[model samples]
Target: MGRPRVTVIDIAQAAGVSKSTVSLVLQGSPLVKGTTRAKVVEAMNELGYVYNRGAANLRQTGSKSGIVGVVVNDLTNGFFAELAVGVDIVVQSAGFVQFLSNTGESIDRQREVVASMREHGISGLLVSPARGTDPSDFAPLVEAGIPVVVVVRSLPGGKLSSVVADNPSGVAGAVRHLVSLGHRRIAFLGGFQDTAVFHERLSGYRSAVTAAGFGFDEALVVPSAPSRAGGADAVARALAVEERPTAAVCFNDAVAFGACDGLRSHRLEPGRDFAVVGFDDVIEARTAVPALTTVSVDPQAMGRRAGQLLLKQIAAGGVSSEAVMTSVRLVVRESCGAPRLAAQA
Candidate 1:
């Protein structure tokens, strides 16, 4: 009742060539003459023949499935969105399709997505892990021999390759810059205490404060949600303290924006009465009122680098277990009061 499926043999017969010639054409082997390849392709088209890459990969030894899995904790954030775009650019150019998933900072969701990717026979994975992800979460993937390249957030003591921005150095630069501006009382705002990023940044903040001959005050550190509302709340709390901070280094651009809002609500100008600095110089940061001063991580570049790393692991058929900490820079803007100071000078 059903029509017969067109096989490579049918294409070969239609083109007056051997089955081997059709196979060669499918593989894009240069061994076959261009004219022969053209003939085979034409025959395939005329006969309605479709090449089954999955079936072919199964027959070949160590052939790639040409699929890479990319998972991020939060796709809603512009930073992560740009990072995913970067991964896509590199992975697409390498003749690979990416299965990208947003975990929304859920550990269970991350585990589910990774397992699904494995079931689909992905050659490699690029992950920006959700909060609270354990080393054991990746054990199944590792055992299955799938190469994984972690991006952005990293899992400590795990034998997995990772690409992350230099968090401590970036935070240090922010702190140093704020201190140089003659702000004696500076606050570290937003971000929960549990994450590695928070720890690294806090360490840098403390080190920079002490290095600059300022007393390390634990009261100056305000832990909150890393969201805009969280930033606002953190600033409100900071203001209630006996010796309110003059400037604040926020967790991210969203937090910085929230801090600015909080300042405005209190009839205080953000750049004038209270200086603010943020991390992840997102696009909005450049255009915001009294544009945000922040750390430039270049999310897209990081994503592309992550893609390159994943491809290498896929090609090698094993994880390199290397950790790459990409560099970050401080981008000065109006929000930090640097521009006004320069003008005055």
Candidate 2:
């Protein structure tokens, strides 16, 4: 027969304390003296006792579970990975554990994971929503009074807190910098037009182009996957135009690298023959062969801020539904011919 289950009563008996004392220790209550708490923990450890947090959470009404759910569209993306890590750093430090889920950009998978997290009784949630996630999709969580902090992308018409970078201003700055470097024929590459991020960045690109006294040529804007392969495809299309672009501002770093690869395939050296700029300024951007010039969003900082916001909402026991637009900046490097221009001066 299997060994009998070890109960809190068993721990209490071994520790020579009351069951109430054991309960206080399990709840991490400060009211329990340090030495007494230590004794209870030691007794539980010796007995190989595992605390069932889920069961304990069910017993207490209106009590914090000390768990936060974090869901991201694509965990494989370095940007999203860093964002999750940032959220973990803050949440862990605040005595909370995070239940992380990857949706791989599937709305259905996102819903499943979010539902599973709800079943686990998470106090709050941080979500980088998948494509086509409607505001109504989160209505249940809102109705249940669970706080949610959206990151990276915004869900239209949702009364939920969100943390997003200034895509418009960042993309505009990239365009302005390229124009300053004598890139008269510039192309916007990568990212599907359906996404809010794509529209925001594209709007900035158009405004910057018009502001620079250049006609907005629709032919120069190529839509593709926001990945390396997509960037390559977009660049090929941009080059096929009657007025081939001399430089391009890509959707993100992955697309920028793809553009560089595409340029090389055509026997053109990036930075020397064609300039390229990317957004996100991912970790690899600095270490890449040409050192990509891009807009910096600081994904980790965004995650930390998002975590803080979620925790704040959890403490208040309600959603603030605030929208935070974080700032971004341009990071000039070799890929955009900035270093070469500097050397000439």
Candidate 3:
């Protein structure tokens, strides 16, 4: 007896439909009529059909080896970890494997990781750049027909597609909330004067402060690290000043945690003696000693949308520069208190 050959062709013949119809059904294209889809599925089951690379291509509409690369600045941060979950969900659903790469915010390391991905046949890249990274580093991939999507941060003057949270709006919202509390002496911590992300947040802070009729105090602003240790060190020094701020708005929750710790070490309760707020609403914010008041960015949603956008671009054969912004909002917690004046007003 000859070997039994079960192909999509056999399934199409049994279903009394064209091969393209069968392909459309398998690909879950909405264009396939409902009744025809049911009939094709029934035929596929009856013929004991087998799937092959062609059917796979019909489903994905891409030449990837069922794999894509997801790169981030720091994996240790919970924000990125949550974002990774969102990316994974979309990749798995599309029948593609997700290869996670952490650059630890190192530009050199990021380049190395990209090279490795290319060697392994990964043609798609999703990245959140490290500080001071050069967009030109990925120019090679861009020229080689690979798709690259930026998340969390946009490269200056680089014509790459990106998805990020509205840092300005989020920061402005936080600052405005504090101003409503009558805190005229609020301070910003954990940010330098440069970097797009930093500037976005800083600009929003300034706008809110100005709109509230307060002067921007460079004396109150402290440049520090975005991590807990960096937060601790900066806060300790700021607290030693003759005129300390009644409220401190941190760059992110990690820095907020450090600030809170520093306040405690100095016998000051964050929400009592002074108010503190953070950004990025990492999971730890909800469980901090005095729960952190923060702006929450839904990393998972951002990741899922980014992945879908990349796939859509691939399906369309190519795409021009597109930017997507995820929404952000404030989560009130124990860490931030209404300034005495706001309470009276």
Q: Each model's TM-score?
A: 0.81, 0.82, 0.78
Please tell me which model should have the higher TM-score, number 1 or number 2.
2
Candidate 2, 292-333: lDDT as tens digits: 999999989999999999999988888679999999999998
| Cα-based lDDT at residue 220, candidate 1 | 92
lDDT of 1 by residue, 1-345 (tens): 234668887888898999988888888888999888888889977875656555466666566588889999878778888888898999999999989999988999998888767656788889988888897788666765678888888789888899988989898999999988888999999987767888888888989999988879988999988888989999999998899999999988878999999999999998888899999988889999999999999889999999999998888877679899999999999999997766776
Arrange candidates by TM-score, highest first: which order?
A: 2, 1, 3
Count backbone clashes in candidate 1: 0
As for TM-score, the candidate ahead, 1 or 3, is 1
Once superposed on the true structure, which residue ranges of model 2 sit more than 4 Å away at CA?
1-57, 60-63
Best by lDDT: 2
lDDT by residue (tens digit), candidate 3, 1-345: 333657788888999999999988876799999999999989876875534433355446665466678999878878889888998899889887888999987888987887777656664788988888888887766765668899988887889999988999998999988877767778888864556888888888888888888878777778787788888887887876678788888888888888998888999989888889999987778888788899988778888999998777766665457888889999887788753434656
- Which candidate has the top score in TM-score? 2
Error of 1 at 35 (Å): 56
Which pairs of residues clash in candidate 1, taking residues 3 or more apart in a chain or in different chains?
Answer: none
Evaluate residue 192 in candidate 3 and report its C-alpha lDDT on the 0 to 100 scale: 46
Residue 151 local lDDT, model 3: 92
Clashing pairs in 3: none
